[model samples]
Target: MIRFENVTKVYDPNARPALDAVNLEIDRGEFTFLVGASGSGKSTFLRLILKEDRATSGSVYVAGQNVANISSWRVPKLRRGIGVVFQDFRLLPQKNVFANVAFAMQVIGKSRSIIRETVPEVLKTVGLEGKERRMPHELSGGEQQRVAIARAVVNRPGILLADEPTGNLDPITSMGIMGVLDKINQNGTTVVMATHDDDIVNEMRKRVVELRNGVVVRDEARALYTSMIPVVGESRRMKDASDAEIDRAQGVQQ
Candidate 1:
């Protein structure tokens, strides 16, 4: 569902690259986690896929569209179908829960006919149906995040990108959000989540991609994060740079 080939992202000419030649692929209906530290290029990698920032060189393709080289005219169309939830939970302060989720469809120019039929269904899916009339401040942190997730999945996009999604919540609330994501993944939307929550990562036991200093140190199928990392271990250091660089290089542009 997503592919990155030879992708590199250098923030400034002199600054170290945010994502150095990142190459990876995520399959449809898979729940994958990107585990990395604050400056480890996980956010940069997510932004590359979102086209919020372009790779300095290489290609990023989503749903087979070459995003690295995507035409300017079609960028909006590409994003309209994909759902993104950031660590901050970008919600409209004035909009209530239902309107917040419904607003996504409205902004995309989806018809009132469609909105009327879809909004409540998605709200129900995210377990926010009764709270639809309440304002953002009226909801708890977890509920507000669920509202964000409802908005994201309302359009039924095939891929979901979440960055630090459960960052602020307690463990139970965080797991609640994870459950929503897992449900969405099970229903066939692809999920690529980037997080630093070690407990959650260990408990989920999903595909794990570990990045350090903008390089992929580990990409293991059904992987477990054995240690707190980019600090993997001496054995990881012995792996060939070419093998590590191989992932960096697979992004659409690197």
Candidate 2:
């Protein structure tokens, strides 16, 4: 459902590319993990799929449409087919869980009846059926993230992109989030997640693509994390870059 052909993204003329000549493909219904240390181009990889940042060179196709060929006015329509969840949760503080999930459909001009029917279904899919009234601050970290997941999938997007979804949660909580993601993938949404959680990566034994300094060092259909790589400062730095990409995309849409 996703393909990148010799993609390279250079932020500055004087600096190296965030993603260098990376060619990858993710099939429909496949769950893949993009695992790498911070600054290894994981975030950049995800952003390219979202069209949040265009590759400096090459092509990115999502579900047969080349994102670079999609016009600015049509970006929202492109985004509607993909759901993105970030490490930050990115919830509206004042909005309750139901409103937050329902907001996605509302922005897309879904009918009140459709929203009413859809929101509860997705909430139940993410195991958040009874917590619709809870505000972001009122829920636990895992629960808040579940709400975020619910929001992402309410529209039943063809692809799900999660960036460090478990970075902020405890081990047990992270496992729970992974379970929810797995469930989503099983239900037939293509899932591509970028994460630094080695233990989770090793345990899940899914398709793994490891990037190092913008190069795809490893791509295995099934693999472990190989080693414990400590990327203490890089995670936050990469996340900041991803956040900036989101802000830029929103600014353009506005």
Candidate 3:
């Protein structure tokens, strides 16, 4: 489970806060979407959850552990339990699909035997079973994103955070990715995604949390990301790539 209680963040020492008094609870096995205009603290919220950035003030708990108070030595282990996918696919330029996914396992010190056996298995889960030898440049954008997903979940993480996961793909490809995420959630991983894709958000019909000016204005058990999404600053890059042009665009990352 992930819980944020009265969480707040202020990036600049002399600037205004980025996130203000956000409170939320995401139960295990549930799929949820975080919606907001750009600069509404959506990215900041994800960073806080991933511990990439600490809250200037407030409490955060993941899997019953307080993230705000976790030891520096334990941060990595905590991240291992949470997988994250960015807007841009972060595959290694020189690595093939197999190597990219196996990379995660190798990082936590998994034995070579397990790495050899487990990599292929996870690839199969994402429907990339036989393309292990293919490089990222050779795969479709959607396919490359799938490889990224495989890498993230290779650790069997209990929580998954995807920020604008489908922003770079077409509607059909977006659905494919969502299907995989839903499947993961079904298998008991908590999913928290930040996105502005109206169709996918509305179609999934999961929990929805909306933010405006860095504060949550709405929270619903079953909400759809529609025209109602808050429109904030540079965050309006929602239409960055249409499905037709997505394949031509390179992946982006945080």
Candidate 4:
């Protein structure tokens, strides 16, 4: 679970705040989408949760503890309960698939036997069972991203944060990645993803939080990419036709 109370983040005194007076909460086992244009504070919101960037004002709580109150020495421990995936698959080029996943556990002082047992299972979960020996360059774009997802969740983090996770892949591939993420959420890992793909958001119909100019404009459950407004005559018919097309696209992917 995560909560932000009247949070504001300012990088420079002369510039506007990246986030301003934003209060939001994400409950355990819920999947939420942070939707906005560029520079709309989506990434800043995530960094505050991770304590990668300190809030200029107000409080951020993760799992009931104020992230700002946590000591610098304990930040690593806090991050161990959260998993992060990025738009760019940040796989270690020199390390094969198995080692890349195992490294997360190893850095936390997990035993070799544990790493050996856990890495393969996670890789298989992400649909990479037979590719354990492959290098990052040898995998396709989607497969590389799957490897990144596997590495992030190998430790079974309580929360998963994905920032533009499907930005680099084709629609079909993005759907596949979303399927993997959905499976993780079903098992009770809270998922918060930031994305700009309208089709994906509209298809998933999850809780959507829209931000603009560092302010929360809309937060709705089972929402589409944007608010729909009433239209008249031919325009209404056109809108209905467009929605039908989107539904067809998603059906084909499924």
Quick one: best lDDT, which candidate?
Answer: 4
Tens digits of per-residue lDDT, candidate 2, 1-254, equal 99999999999879888998989999999999998778879999988887889999999999998999999999988899999999999999999999999999999999999999999999998999898898999999999999999999889999999999999999999999999999999999999999999889888999998887787767787778753343346544755575587689789999
lDDT of 4 by residue, 1-254 (tens): 99999999999879889999999999999999999878879999999999999999999999999999899999998999999999998999999999999999999999999999999999888899999999999999999999999989999999999999999999999999999999999989999999999999999999999877677777889999986544557545644665586689789999
Ranking by TM-score: 4, 1, 2, 3
Error of 3 at 219 (Å): 0.7
Error of 3 at 64 (Å): 0.9
- What is the clash count of model 2? 0
Clashes of each: 28, 0, 2, 0
Choose the strongest candidate by TM-score: 4
Which regions of candidate 3 fall more than 4 Å away from where they truly are?
227-254
TM-score per prediction, in order, is 0.89, 0.88, 0.88, 0.89
**Candidate 2 off by > 4 Å:** 227-254
In terms of lDDT, model 1 sits at 0.86
- Runs of candidate 4 exceeding 4 Å displacement: 229-254
Worst lDDT run of 10 residues, candidate 2, spans 227-236
RMSD of each: 6.7, 8.5, 7.5, 7.6
lDDT of model 4 at residue 115?
92
Sequence-dependent TM-score of model 4: 0.89
Query: Which sections of candidate 1 miss by over 4 Å?
Result: 227-235, 238-254
lDDT of 3 by residue, 55-110 (tens): 87889899998897898999998999999998898999799999999888887999
